[model samples]
Target chain A: MKRLSRLALAAALMLALAVPVSAQVSDGVVKIGVLNDMSGVYSDLCGPGSVEAVKMAVEDFGGKVLGKPIEVVSADHQNKADIGANVANKWIDVDKVDVIVDLPNTAVCLAVQKICQDKNRINLISTGASVILTNKNCSPTGFHWTYDNYALGKGTGTAMVKEGGDTWFFLTADYAFGHDLEKSTAEAVTKSGGTVKGSVRHPFPCNDFSSFLLQAQASKAKVIGLANAGGDTINAVKQAAEFGIVQAGQRLAGLLVFISDIHSLGLKTAQGLVVTTGFYWDQNDETRAWSKKWSARMNGRMPTMAQAGCYSATMHYLKAVQAAGSDEAKAVAKKMREIPVNDFFAKNGKVREDGRMVHDMLLAQVKKPEDSKYAWDYYKILRVIPGDEAYKPISETECPYLLEKK
Target chain B: MFELIGIPPQALFGQMLLGLINGAFYAVLSLGLALIFGLLNVINFTHGAQYMLGAYVAWLLLNFLGINYWLALVLAPVVVGAFGILLERLMLRKLYHLDHLYGLLLTFGLALIIEGVFRNLYGISGQSYPVPPVLTGGYNLGFMFLPLYRGWVVFVSLVVCLGTWLVIEKTKLGSYLRAGTENPTLVQAFGINVPRMITLTYGFGVGLAALAGVLAAPIYQVKPTMGADMIIVVFAVVVIGGMGSIMGSVVTGFMLGLLEGLTKVFYPEASNTVIFVVMAVVLLIKPAGLFGKAS
Candidate 1:
């Protein structure tokens, strides 16, 4: 009877040992979590569209790395920091996701940044524009992809100033992202020898901007730099058009404009607006082909820059995983910086030591209603600012990781 | 160089005008809430969703049936009001005898369902409704440009608020409503169809919210979440106005809107919270509310 009990205990131990071995070999799946604002104000920019974009990247990468199947999962942050952190923890612990991508809001991005640092998982931020992501809060596991507010401000601010828009007024959203945008753009305006006449900070998610536009109009500034994103930018621009601020000969510079915002405003109202973008779907044949595939799955809505960046970032991460021959976060991240990111979205894109993805950004103006020949044909590219000239210089970076190494 | 308190007058007046337009919306929405609360004793938490429905209905009419803005102004309210009537008979009426909290909770659940359905149908990115051709441009008022559509919104909202006030305060039907609100049992003893009156009153209150929604469509993006954002502030306005009289909501809505506007000019940071701050103060100093009668 004692010998029978010992044999039974040995079988139980074998079952426990066999489960995780199969999990690591037969179905060694690599999971990527797309944590974003799936159902909120920023959904149109990076919600379900981004998820599909990442999936396309996986398919294009042949769907397996080191003989392991790649799977995609998603969760909505609901634009809350605490909820984002909780989702991050679950994705890292319970789901064993190797990478998290496409976080749009700054508050949620910062929250997830800390969690990724704690877990040593790769965080590929595709939509967040806060400069602090690469500055004070930089982490070894975090990569600020697409564009940041500093780059956006530089792209649009320099262009506007060169066009003789020497005087400026800013209508800023009152939040961390907004504050960073205004500061960065203001610095760019000053560097270009332009003077800032005045500025006002309006509450975020503000329904009305009539008063703020009037203040910009009253400032008599040559350009009104709108340092906001998503719906805030659309509303301010729509109201600025209504108030005849643009008709009065002042330019409206959307520092962080997206294709989604232009679509929301329609070309008629958004026409003549100067903005900067990391990718325009119709910019080239490769982009058009990829965007066609994206739009087919996205219900005919073209991919925004943020969504496109998701595809590029995910594809590159998978490539690095294969190159490193492991799904380890530190190994994949180090390989990410070592390789050049070449995809339909970004060509020759280089990830910096500070985890800032350096790529060429475009300066585009909204096509006039009559100028637009087809649907979703909104931008007329004015110039291409090279990757080196677009992003903030590395010497100026305040990332503690970089600073400590130096 | 024309400045007020170190700020330009154009900025000040522009914000105030915007504030007044916002006030117009507040007055209309709060007026509906107050009317429903007075007759039904339910908080009508679905007010925001109902308001959103009004805009969606107008958008559908224009897109699908080629209905113009004027027709939608009349038609949207009627359609939404009919929905409200059906809801009252089938659902809300069942909760009439229960606690007021139950009514609030049930309507709140209804609100989530309504918002969820809309969100599923048409994501959160709002659909744009253009300003009517006739009211497309604005006249320069020297200090600031006043868009014609905005002026129309303010004017129509005032007329509607006043019209609702006169109907409730002066007319014979208004007398029935007031009597029913005061003592429903006594009013029923006087040979009136009290249940039918309650149903119609709920419909009328809902219709008022739809009307405001139609007015707001052109100014704000016609989105599912639009009403959700505005309704919370309107509740604060209703609380401050105290649901005491029909006109109280109108007066307080406009006054607070203007106050919020002035706050934006003086202290832009507090513009969003100023209304709630006032609510807290009012709650502390006068729990009965400014216009509310002591229970």
Candidate 2:
């Protein structure tokens, strides 16, 4: 009877060992959720293109991790912070998503980041511009992958001020996004020995820029810096032409612009305009190759810098999952910070302990009519702002994690 | 010291003139919205889309038909207004008895459809419309330069607003319309076609928005989203002005625009929110609005 009991115990132990080995061979699928402004203003940059970018990364990585298929799902957060947070929570709990990607709006990203941290999920933020994500409210579980307001302001404003566009006037959009852009750009202007003659804050989606344009004209500033993006930027540029602000020797600086905005303004109106960004479509052979594939998927719309960031983050996340040998969120996240992220967008880029994937930024100028050779040709490379030079100093950031470590 | 704190007369006068120009657009758009809401009780959320259609129609006229701005300014509204009339007769006329929110929803859907189609075709870029040669250049007013086109906007809008007011208030047709709004069944008994009047009123409101759009084309780019943003602010304007009286909407629009301009001069940070702030204050003091009727 004792011998029979021992045989049964041996059989049970063997069964338990077999079950774990089989589970290790095929555990569970890695689900990643991409939340963004799918149907709103930032749609062109990080909307459908972001989805496509993630799919490309999955495909390029062979679409499997830990012997399980990879799955991607996306939603339009509609640029609302509350909606974004809710979506993030549901994606983590209900869908069992391991990562959330491409949150565009700063406020929405901040809210969604908190949710991801609470749920112990990874968040790869690509489109938001607020410095606060990495400054006051940085999270270990969230990675700020692309450019921010301070980087854009420092790269564009300081460069323009040094280039002899001394006096500045601002036509700012009235929103958190606009306010941050204006504040950072204004700081750069002052630091570079440029004087901000005056500024006018217009309501978002304002149609008639006549009053604002007239105020800018009256300021007599040499450069009329547009601290607005998307439709606001397009309107300000068009009206500046109508009001002849450019003819009066006032240069226009688009602090944050997309390829779509440049295409809308066309070469005639957008000529000689300087802007700063972390990516451009026609930057190099690798960029062109990636853009060519992305264009085929995005209905011929060229990939913006934000779109490129989406690709980099997704590729890095999948690689980390593979490295960790599991789809568990905490394990994958720890692997992410440890691994060096290398791609066409970045060379030897490392995801910092504080969850910032540092990369190079570019300063580009809109080409003149004569410089254009095709339909969507917009910008010419001005200078390659190095990765270290493009972003704000990490020492300057007031993030609690960074402070605690120090 | 006086020159430092107090705006120079030239600058202040120039800004006020600019304010008046902006007010012209506000007045025209608000008047159209009020007219539609007062009679048909439809929020016409697609007002901006219709305005965009007017600009695009003008652009198409100039691009394909070789029509000038002068011709487009006259014919574009008519074309857009006809589109509005058809929309009213076919779709909007069916929703009069349903919840008012449905009308808002339907119009909002129509707006999405129009904007999406435009964005798909033309993309989200701005298309330039040249100023008519006649209105090109600026006139020096000793204090600042006034573009001729801006002055034209203010003058033309004033004429249109007052003309609309006169038509709705002083004429026999206007009286019949007012009677129709009060009791459409009774007006129908008097041998007047109330439904036709309602349809025409919607068409006229759409036409007014289109006209304002045409006026804005040269000053602003003819873009898909031109109207989407403007219409929201106009809604706020409509809410604050209290849709109770036509003239009240006009006065309130101009006053708020001037207030916004003043904020730009002094506290630029609050410029965008000043109109909303005023609306809140007015709502607190009188929930019916500054000029709105009690619901």
Candidate 3:
């Protein structure tokens, strides 16, 4: 009778060890919640498009992982951090979302990152350009999947400076994201032997930039770094052209411009503007194939890098879950960092210990109206910024995840 | 070589010119609001949406019909004005007997619905209207490189604001309109169709708003939310100028614009709020406003 009891115990232990992944999945399903600005200024770039990207990734990943069906849900944070935190809490506590992705606004991203960490759910940051996430407030379960402000600022700052734009004046939005971009770019400018003449902070979402533009024009800086995004960036760039700032011999460097911005400004105005991006849909054959499929889903609108990051991050997270055979946040995060990302959006990109996905960023210039050959052919790739140089160096990361690991 | 508070005279003057240009928008927009409030006694919260529609109509005319700017400048206001007439006839007419809050709420809802429809159809980035061929370049004014398109706005908007103000405060038609608002039942007994006059007045107020919209199309991005950004400030301008004070609205608009510009030169962070600050102070001290008649 004692021997029979021992044999039964051994059988139960072996069975529990064998399929731990399926057993550990909180519920019978793996849920991915896409939390972003669904109905605000960022809606076009990171809202519905991100949700679609994550769904596409799940479909492409065979609809199931570890015998559990993958489900995607989305909500709008309305560009408010408290609202974002509330959504993140409900998603993790009630909905059992294993990962949340595509946080666009900086404050929302910062708020949601802390929530996911406390709840042990992985947070995939696809947008939200602030560098503070990986610097001061990073988490073990958090991974910055796409580009950050530092990478964008450094690449553009270096490129512009090399092209004789050694003096820069920034027209910044008076907000955390804007200041982050300006500080990052300014650091890069000085590092590359350039000088920042001055900077002016304008109200966020300001429609009129003539006040700040005149100040920039007065400074006579060789380049004006627009450290603002969305409508703010569009207005500043438009007014800069109207004021003939470029014609008067100053260059305009849109440090963190998105393709949607170019699409709005059109080539006539956006032409010759230098910018930095993480992914371009027209870069190569693989990108073209993926973008064709993605853009078709987006009603012929090309996917922005933020949307592309959604797909790449979700796919990699699923793969991590599959490899590690558990939906446990730390285990999946570990596997994700262990695997090198080789996909349409990135080639052998790496997620560092500090939770940043270091990939080669593209430095491109807006093609003139006549130079554009096809629909959405907005950029002419001027250079490829290497991953090592584009991303924040590992030595500088203040992420507790890495600091504790070391 | 002269400087004011450490800024070169050139920069200060350049900023001042930009401020004046912004003020032109305020003046025209507030003039429309004043006209409506003075006559109809209805707070036209839809004024900003009307302005946005004006810009969109101009963009459509140029892009679809191949109509030029000068033609769109005339046609857009007329078209948007007719729409306003329909709005006044079908919707606003029924709400006249209700409290002021009802009209405000109704117009506010209408504004949201209009903005939502546009956004749903044309997603947010907004379209760009190029500078007209005639106004492609700019004039170097030593202090600033003033785009001819922008300069034309300053010149034309000022004339329109003054002209509208004159016609309202001077002409025979203006007298009847003012009389109709003062004692509508008595004016009806005088054989004038007060309802038709009120509807037309509301339409005209909306038209003026659209006129400013067309003027702004080239300078600003033609987006759904553009009107939303301007509406609150324009409303503040109306309040500060007194609800129905036409000339007061015009003069106060320009002065506030200049004040905002000066603030930008000295403390740019407070520029967006300067108008509101002035409005608050005026509300606290001179509730009747600078040009308003006290009740």
Q: What are the candidates' individual DockQ scores?
A: 0.61, 0.43, 0.72
Candidate 1 chain A lowest-lDDT run of ten:
A19-28
Per-residue alpha-carbon lDDT of candidate 1 for residues B68-124, written as tens digits (9 for 90 to 100):
899999999999999999999999999999999999999999999999899878877
The stretch of ten residues in a row with the least summed lDDT in candidate 3 chain B is B160-169
Give the per-residue lDDT digits (tens) of candidate 2, residues A239-341. 7776777877879899998877777667777788899987887877988898899899877888887888888999988888788776656777799989887
lDDT of 3 by residue, B1-295 (tens): 7777899999988888888889899999999999998888899999999999999999999999999899999999999999999999999989999998888998999999998888887788899999898998899999889888888998988898889878877998888888987889998998999999999989899999999999999989999999999999998888898889988888888888888888877887888898999999999999988788888
lDDT of 3 by residue, A141-221 (tens): 899988999999999999999989999999988888999999999999998999999998887789888888889999989
Which regions of candidate 2 deviate over 4 angstroms? A1-27, A195-202, A213-220, A329-341, B1-5, B37-45, B59-68, B94-137, B166-194, B221-225, B235-244, B276-295
At residue B90, what lDDT does model 2 achieve?
A: 95
What TM-score does candidate 1 reach?
0.95
Which pairs clash inside model 1? none
Instruction: List pairs with backbone clashes in candidate 2.
Output: A264-B125, B242-B292
Interface RMSD of every candidate?
Answer: 1.2, 2.7, 0.9
- State each candidate's clash count: 0, 2, 1
- Range of the 10 consecutive residues with the lowest summed lDDT in candidate 3 chain A: A17-26
Instruction: Give the range of the ten consecutive residues with the poorest summed lDDT in model 2 chain B.
Output: B1-10
Ranking by lDDT: 3, 1, 2
**What's the distance in Å from true for residue A103, model 1?**
1.3
- Candidate 1 lDDT tens digits, A335-387: 99999988878889999998999999999999999999998999999999999
**Candidate closest to the true structure, highest lDDT:** 3
